[model samples]
Target: MATSIESHVVDITTCAICLEKLNIPKYLPCLHTFCESCLRTYITAIFEKEHKQSIECPVCRTTVTISKEVNTPDEWAKVLPLNFLIVGLLEKEKLRDHKTMHGEELKLFCADHHTPCCSMCVSIHHRRCAKVLSIEDAAMEYAKSDEVKYLKTHLANVDYDVKVIIKDRSSAKENIDKDYKRKQRDLEVIFSDLVAKINDLKVRREAELLKIYNEVKETIDTTLIFFQNKQKNIENEKQIIDAAVNMASNVQVMIEVEKLKKQVEEHKQVIQSKTKEIVNYELLLQDVENITKLAEQMEKACQISCKKPNTYIALSSVTVTPNVSEIFSCCRFGQHTCSWGVKGAKQDAICVSLSKEIELYGLLSYVCKDALATCDVTATVKDDTTDLVVVKDTIDSKVAENNTVKIMFPKPVKLLANKKYHVVVVMKGTSWCYAGGDGETVVDSNGVVFTFNNSPLSNNGTNTNAEQIPGFVFKISDEL
Candidate 1:
């Protein structure tokens, strides 16, 4: 008995709305596959009518929505064998039609030439053209050839090069990371050094400030104690005077009053001395305070944003110069001569007048051979001049005969404001024959030499003379 042949059941996955086998199926989180378009349209309908825009999966009730752009059939062809299915369907249809006409052979033809061509000729003549061919011919002649094998090998080489490039890029990234770490370490070292220097400077400046403060405080405290003691003594003496005034008629009171007066005088002297000491201490304290304040200001001025090692050292190296006044003066003395008397004794006498004037505050140091030297040196606000001082003396040395002697002064004194002073030297003597006749006796010249601080002055061969002396005029001010 010929039974009816049962057809093979094909399981088809499809979208419900389109009733077409799904070419590009998007699987939702709910585990349902639908055509990308059907999912999008279903979600749009839900959005328009319902307040809730989310759509539920068809198969499962889980909420899911389509992506904005649907994946096309071409994209789906990437992962699935959809193109192979189409080719297989077309092949089956051709075979069925060929079987119906039994007398004529079914000939495979190249679609491009529209004529029957052998499989080898089809592949060689129409290769890479957009033309269709019988499935049997395509499979037998083109797919089985060495050309296909070569293409596969080329693809493999291309993949290998891609992997090499990726490895090299990774190596480069690692090198960059190492270099960054090294630079970070160097910066950290520099930061640490800067911090250390800042701390050192803070400590040094703090010590200096404390030292100055302590010294000034000690002086002020001592002065306060001294003044307190003096005040107590003055009060006790005043009480004695008051008690004596009440007992005037008594003889003992009279004697006590006299003794009290003496005591008062002594107390006055003590008070004066204490007052002077206090004033002096006060002045010294003020000077110390000023210095301390200046140091504070300097610390502020020298503060810097960045810490550097040499900053404090350089600041401390600066030198300060004080204001100074200079003055000079000069004076001259007479000459001397030697003679022989009739008794074969040597006689020597000198007549000398020494005169010198110096600028105010000038200091002088002088030396002479005989007592017969006379000299006067004076200094004034406006000028430095010399006047004569009497001299009677004799110098015995022949080399010293009529030779000059000089008074030398180093580092000329600062001129006092609006003041004048004199430096005088006197000498008197006779020649070797003191009680005898006198011959020609020359007077030795006496002179004064002066120099200003940092000024040019020289001593010539003669002791009585110098090259130059500096002089100055000054006026005192209330501010000084």
Candidate 2:
């Protein structure tokens, strides 16, 4: 058995192509071993001649693929570290032969001299020189030193620090995200409140402006009504005067000799009565002179003018302007000159006595009992006046047994036939003695009182309540 095994082993050790001990043996996947040179040459020749991309093993004709598996030799067992089984299979002599033949030449150089050296030369000659070191010697020493050991320790510390830093970074990022969300919520609430407040203020301002506009409109309307009435009165007065002048001229033309003689006797009485009537009318007109002036004064007090009316009347003829002063006299009384009165008394009560006329108008008719007293009344007539008729009167006060006073004027005088008029009254109480000494003056020393009522009436009739006064009234005629 020993003899037969020796022969088999010898046969396996020899290369089929080279016929030499299989040095640098390369085993195929077919379990056949061959010389490395022979296999390399064969693959090269086949690739060059046939342009084949892959080859088959000689023994089994299995495809010898050139991937990781083919790139490694089957005989790599000889190069690996020896174990008990490996040593038994391959003799020490065969192993040495494999290494000597297959091992690639390794050329080591001195770092300083740049000269190649063998392994024997590195161990003996490069021992003492500082710069004269071999690549192999340096590599071996670096692998075993404390520097390598320290690098290992540093690498472990670095890994631990990196893990701690990563945790902290993640936690900080989470906190930042939470804070940002909170701020976003707060901003939304603040913006909503601001928008609501702005809208409220806008609504309030709009309401206030609307109210002011309405008030202004009402004032404008009132002023317009006042001027419209004045304009109508002016036109009416012009027409009345023209008619009176025409009548007088026609009567003068109708005079005859025989008729004149008989008419002269009758004319005296008629003329006398007519003159009295004229005087009474003139007095009535005079009483309201101050009131008319007051109206004009009141109109002037306002700065704005009335808008022009849609329609207007024209005056056809002019009349002689009467003397307004001849009608009423202004009087001032009292220590402080705080009271104003207008007075005119005529004898013959039937001749429209001033007392009766004053009482009739009810201007100052409140003080009728004290018409004559140790007192004086006064009035003020303003310039550039309009629309106020002032009437003054006195009457007996049933409650106090003293004289009561009154004053009044028209609110808005209407224009009739181109003429407008107003009346105002003013009065004050005075001390009087009956059967005793001077009567005790009432403590109501604030006696200066004035009242005003408006009449659009063309002529003075019975006094009416202010509320009863008609609105604007006028007759429109083309000729005025």
Candidate 3:
């Protein structure tokens, strides 16, 4: 049985053509095998002689068709699947042959050289190495070393970490897909709605553009049809005259000639004409330009507005109840002087009269020379006759723009029409706030003057003539 096994191993592994061990073994159609290089030489010689592409088995002489596309034996071998079972048998035979010649295993291991060494190998190569031990003892000793334990632990940790990395990579891909789909959906909603809006406007604008064009086209068609009918009638009359002249006798011709002449004269009479409706191209162009302007305006106007009063109302004149609101505000880049300083508990008064009563919602002022970068102040408007406070506003200094300060009244006060009022402004910070201006003071034709003093004064020119107050810039809404 052992002899048979040995013969069978040699038979299975040996190449028939080479009569030696198969190096890169190749198979033929008849299940016969040969060495790749030897078979390639035989195929090349056949190709040279017969100029045909085929592999002929050396044992069975069975012809196998080689691929026409393959130009060389190396390329042809690559095209075929490797015979892995034959390869495994060859490997087993090789190990068996090794054991037969050199024994089953090495008995010693050279630690310094880090390789298995037989007795002959040690004598030949490992004689200079410092460490050598029995193979079994070397294996046991290295297995218990600290470095080995550390290597094992680290390998286990790396395996666990690699699994986690794969899972996270998969999760990242899923997250990317999820976000991509979500963003696409949001874009679809916004742009699709915008497309719908644009389409609707397109229909409306196109309809407007086409209305005049259709009307003009219809008119031209009507005019062409009328002239065509008239032309056909004239041609029919000419044809009839030609027939009469050909078929009529001389006496009949004499009678028909006068009748034809009279008919021609009658045909010469002018036909009543209808006035053509002409569309003005200039007017049409104007309409188009207006629509283009509207498009540009709405493009910027229809932005996504935030939650604020950038929203506006275009109120009609009739909606305003009969009240005195400010009309004109001509700003005076006036000198920054003539200030009334009412610091601490002290206050200053300035009186200004209006020919028409005004509904006071807000007031404006300028700094006296320079004060704190920001200042706090309070203003009170009082009825001169009634001595009752009409409106009061506290001005907290904020980012001032262009050196002008404005504060809106918490509650708007409608002053009595054509009546004089005393405005007392108290400075909370160490700064003066003017309630009236010098030449900048604007009064109607009713000789309404202005008065200013350091101390709070009563009405009626402060017991004397009123001075033109300064630094008081007033803003109003009613018509002058």
Candidate 4:
């Protein structure tokens, strides 16, 4: 019986300091109970060595204050409050031991008090109370009661709730890690783009400076070579005059002197003309006054934005370009007699209606004649009544083949769902590209539908819709 009772409650009555059953259990402010003698020894050592009026709990390390009135260590330990629960448990243990030694069976139970009682306790304590039953009958009734069923059900619900909370927390942690990596990648891309632009600017400026310097240096070098040649000619003339005076006849010397005089006048005139052409070429660097201001602006470019829970930003998925071979295969817009200039004020355009919100990455246009000038393909949303542009993206033609050309926007354009937008490819001075449309409505591999307009749109006032539609397909990404 003692072993069975101890199995349920031995730790509760044990003292933390002595590691045994509590003796005169005293509790500190932190609710940790300890033996009185153990506390006295611990508190006395603290007061003597450290000369402090407070001690930390052995278990939880909470400070416990000693009252000023309690002068001695023994008094300090004695002044702590007693743990009534521990004392009651100890008393119950003593009672159980007495019952076992004397062989007194507590076979009766008082239902009103809800406790097992010996025969003597029933006659003395529960004599006036009714509703007393044998302990075995009471136990059997409790086992079949609704209270037991409710307890089991409640415990099962609590277990399920605990499991769900743990799983949710784990999932939240994983999402946090993924978001961290994605945001880090975004930050790197932004900085890398800035660095690339700065480096490109630096290279271009350096090349310009070097080109100017080389041109000026070459001009100066040529001028120096011309002066050296004139000096050599004069020296040769002087040597000829010296030889004529020393070895030639008087007539020959006079003729040599006249020729030398004429040559000297010609050389002087050439030198004067060359001096007028000599320029003071000094290289000047136009300083960037806004560089410091740009640096200051760049410092505030990226900001850390924290969003609330359940807020998410989606990323675009890579997708293949749509196939529009059927749309452009039937007829040609600019084939032989008619040509659409790339930079011309007149434009060839295709109007498309989108089914859902999409991010436009690029546009694909068919090319019949080779591109003469760089083309600007623009996508614009207009108000139906006013024809004012809402959103627009214009990108220069980057890659143009004889078959088809791809013009990509520097940044993706976000178009709303269920809206009609026009993509216009403009050209001017020389005509090169040919495209056809109005064949069929085609769906891309990414499930984006491209509904072709019945007629091609043009500012040139030409009605060529019945023959062909503008051949173009929008490059849509999955993310907004």
lDDT winner: 4
lDDT of 2 by residue, 47-148 (tens): 678777566776567876554344333233333222222222233233223111123332344544433355555556654444544445644443454432
Q: Rate the local accuracy (lDDT) of all candidates.
A: 0.34, 0.33, 0.47, 0.52
lDDT of 4 by residue, 109-145 (tens): 6778766677888888899888788766765564455
Which stretches of model 2 miss by more than 4 angstroms? 1-199, 243-376, 379-403, 407-480
Supply the global lDDT for candidate 2.
Answer: 0.33
Question: How far off is residue 96 in model 3, in Å?
Answer: 2.2
- Which is the leading candidate under TM-score? 3
Give the per-residue lDDT of model 1 (tens digit) for 89-162: 23222223322122444244454543444445545675755665563554345434543334334323333322
- lDDT over C-alpha atoms for residue 382 of model 2: 20
Model 3, residue 279: distance off in Å is 67
The best-first sequence of candidates by lDDT reads: 4, 3, 1, 2
- Poorest 10 consecutive residues by lDDT, candidate 2: 346-355
The better-scoring model by lDDT among 2 and 3 is: 3
Give candidate 4's root-mean-square deviation (CA, Å).
43.0
TM-score of each: 0.23, 0.18, 0.28, 0.26
**TM-score head-to-head 1 vs 3, winner:** 3
Which is the winner by TM-score between candidate 1 and candidate 4? 4
- TM-score quality measure for candidate 3: 0.28
Per residue, candidate 3 scores C-alpha lDDT tens digits across 97-132 of 322115535667788865666888888899999999
